[model samples]
Target: MTFQPAGATTIAAKTPASETARRNQPLQSFDLLVGPLSFSQATRRGLAFYLLSDGIAVWLATTGLVAQAFVLLGLSRLLAVAFGRLAAGRRSARRGLVAARRPWLEALLYLFTLAVVAAANGTGSFAASLSGFPASQALRVSAATAIDAAVGYLTVQGDGFFRVVTRGLLSLLKGLEAILTLTPWPVLFAVIGFAAWKRGGPMLLAVVWAALGYLGLFGYWAEALQTSALVLASLCVCLVIGIPVGILLAKSPVSRAIASPVLDLMQTMPSFVYLLPAVAFFSIGKPPALIATVIFALPPLVRLTCLGIEQVPLHVREAMQAHGATPLQTLLKAELPLALPSIRTGINQTIMMCLSMVVVAALIGGGGLGYNVLFALQNVQYGEGILAGLGIVFCAVLFDRLAGSGRKGGA
Candidate 1:
């Protein structure tokens, strides 16, 4: 059963002829199809130019350059419909001349009505603009004066609302300042050693304490506190609206559908767009900044709250239902407890978003670390800007870590 291989001469003799025949076959076929191929090429070239010109025309129309084309088309269609209707009405009345002439008269009437409507709309817009301009100016001046007066009053009294509220904060800082200033390095090391024993080990404790010492050396302690306060206030406002909206959306499908588009717009629109409206309404200062931050930061909380409630297990809901639990009771007991972790994460995200926005908000006169950072940027003081930016970052990290830890522990 042994098979013999072909010799090289025999194999070469047969190969080239077949190869030449196959190559020639394609040329023969091309000769037959050339007329059709030429026709296709011409057709394709024409189509490409046609499509390209059409695309350009469409773009021009969309951008308003060819707006008159659309206007003419609309008018033509309207006239055709009006004429048809008039003809029908006249035929029914057995009046040919009136039917033929009525369409033109109707079209003129429509044109007049359109003009009237447009005039009214234009007048309304003009009046609104005029009214809003004065109010906007008044609000801006009032907001600026109020903020300046408040700051000046606090500065003069040294015992105003801010001072009273920040007393505990000042005390905490003073204690830390005393400890870092007066305590021996060895005593600090000993405290670190104690923390290491309680928490993990000496290495972890050393890293933590070193970070604290570095922050102090960089003089970021006070800036950090101020940033924290700003973020806290922003998050509080975000939650006040976000959570309720979320709950409402979760309970009502109609609400969810209605709100989803608005949320999408809010979340997708540029953060800078928010600034103009905020300035228009609230004017520049912490309040406007607060409003912007809330708008920017609140979407996640609402979205997450709706998500968390929806994700609750059906069985758990059914169990509550079987036990004759009312909707509110079921939500309070079963749903909220399970949804807390998600809500907390949303809150954490809200805080982070607020922290990031505060810097942008500074452009519109937000104070605290935001103002400091903006001042540094404007004055070309890199050191000050970097320090203030880092202060904001530290506060964000601290809040995120603390909130995350609470979420984990609570769960």
Candidate 2:
């Protein structure tokens, strides 16, 4: 029943749904090119080289036999490449051009790995060769011994210096602890409540008081004070060292590049790893605990400070210079002011991280809520451990909230 003009072409009675969608989105319509890709010149050459490498590797692995197999395999692989290259040249459209791909490289790795293991294990009648040995323990032992020797040497030579540093740290710890523990409880509560109210309003004030009340009611006030002292001491050390290092890194790309890997290592290294060197240098007690906490918590502040400084707007720096400001003045006024939020964030993160280490540091004679937790854990006292852990949590949050308070009263 259909009618058509004399020169008209026949049309499909029904268009497919896919075709209909493509018609609707004509600008976006395209075929997804899943690839068995057409070879480029580099790809052609790389394949040939890869085949040659494989042949050589196999020949070497076969132990003086099967060297001729390589020639046959190499010739066959090269011939395939040659035919592919010719077919590629005849093509007018590059239908299979694709993004970077090195599946062949991965294949090569697997082949080589298998070849190596076989050679090391001995191929049929071939004695195991001296090359490609992944199963050896002698090297590891020697390295461990060398490290131990170095640590021992350092321990012997640096005893006096370590002792002096330990004394200084212990004095600082005791001083802070004395002040915290000796202060009248009401005065301390008033100070905390007032600061909380001022910074975070009445809600924060209530939370702060509740946390403190838990510690006092459960007879954990003294331990809480000890934990705070540790955190505050560690915070001071972190700020003293971290800020300048951060500023230096921000200003100098070379220093930043060098320090970046070290910072990454510090942040990623297990907190327990620092404990050995700390214990060796400072011995067990508050000093070693402080050292461990400082190492554990130092990275965030440094990172944040550098990020803040780097994030300061370029125009602001230029404006400062335009006003005839010196480098110091520009940094002090323009950069630091603008970077304060980030810097404050860094400080708060450092405080929290510092608090977390308290429990771990307890393994090295760090007494406080952490000690209580550890003691309770050792005896399998669930109730005591949970209560002590809550005490630590309250201390952590209390400090974190205070640390996060805004300077301009809107935090």
Candidate 3:
């Protein structure tokens, strides 16, 4: 618990027990095996006895003699307890209880586990059969029917707010597609290349140019542009939603506890699973595709942004506070700057996720290189599918490089 000067770096010191162990080396190579487990003189014998017994119990269990296994386990546990008590002779009840409890607890656990295994094998049931008149399919159908009825009721009754939002998002996606597809290829290339150069230097700029050039040269110019626009739009949507939520999560432990499982669900569910809800709400098109992409790719940025902010070196924030910096000032100047590299990494992963969903996104009405790839798959055009896939790879590489540069620069 030694403290250093505020500006000085801290190094960890070895514990006294470890230093003692190092100084008092074991007498033989075999003794070295017991060194780690022997934290105290009395416990060493107890541990060794318990391990030997436990091994025998496990071996007996593996031989299909369940009753014998339990007997062995109990016998070994009793022996360990006896040894421990012998070593701790004439101790108080409290101390004796503390010393003896470990073996009893371990024995009970092993006994219970063996009993369950024996029961399972004897009954010929792994999970055991359930006897009931329950109607699972009926329950599922009823739930689905109720939900569909409710949604239909809402739709019929004119849900202005929901309808308005859906329409607006759809219009926005359409407008973005038109702009990207209508823009001259050379102009788009120059704009992207310039951005790459400004953020990533000359090497990245060349990569960006080559990737874009290949897309155009291979006759995937329009599809590439469309996919780029869709991916960019989805990324923007993810950031707009994810960052604020991430900041909230970082600042509030309660929010983090609530969000952890939701993020897990978002990340764990298949990408296509999102499309079902999107289609239900938006009714299938570019808008639904965009929404699904955002959902699929958003968790990483939110989780990483939260983690980055939380890991902003407590001392640095404290120093900022000591200098009369407000909370927002400390966060923006001290925390966010240090967290920039991690946030950039989050953004990189989000972009890649969005790109990966391109072909899946095309399954609905969302058109792009995904649509081209899907068309090839349907028509059995191997060359077309391969070219489209290569186009996607090129775009992914260019974006990945740009993200790498941003991350390094932040670092």
Q: TM-score for all predictions?
A: 0.51, 0.71, 0.68
Question: In model 1, where do residues sit more than 4 Å from their true spots?
Answer: 1-212, 406-411
lDDT score, candidate 1, position 132: 45
Instruction: Arrange candidates, best TM-score first.
Output: 2, 3, 1
Model 2: lDDT to the true structure: 0.77
Q: Find the candidate with the highest lDDT and give its number.
A: 2
Ranking 1 against 2 by lDDT, winner: 2
Task: Give candidate 2's TM-score.
Answer: 0.71
Q: How many residue pairs clash in each candidate?
A: 0, 0, 0
Candidate with the larger TM-score of 1 and 2: 2
Query: Can you write out model 3's per-residue Cα lDDT over 1-411, one digit (the tens) per residue?
Result: 954544332222444765544433322212222323545543543455456546756776787755566564554445444554444444424343222223344344445555554554454444363223446898899999998898787666656765786787777777787898888877888888878888777767777899988998989888887898889889888989998899899999999999999999999999988898777767878888998999999999999999999999889988998999999999888888898888988999999999999999999988989999999999999999999999999989878886665422321
Find the candidate with the highest TM-score and give its number.
2
Ranking by lDDT: 2, 3, 1
Candidate 3 pairs with clashing backbones:
none
Report, for every candidate in turn, its global Cα lDDT versus the true structure.
0.63, 0.77, 0.75
The digit string of per-residue lDDT tens for model 1 on 71-163 reads 533443355445545555666466322222223343344345334333333446664554343457788999989977875665566546444
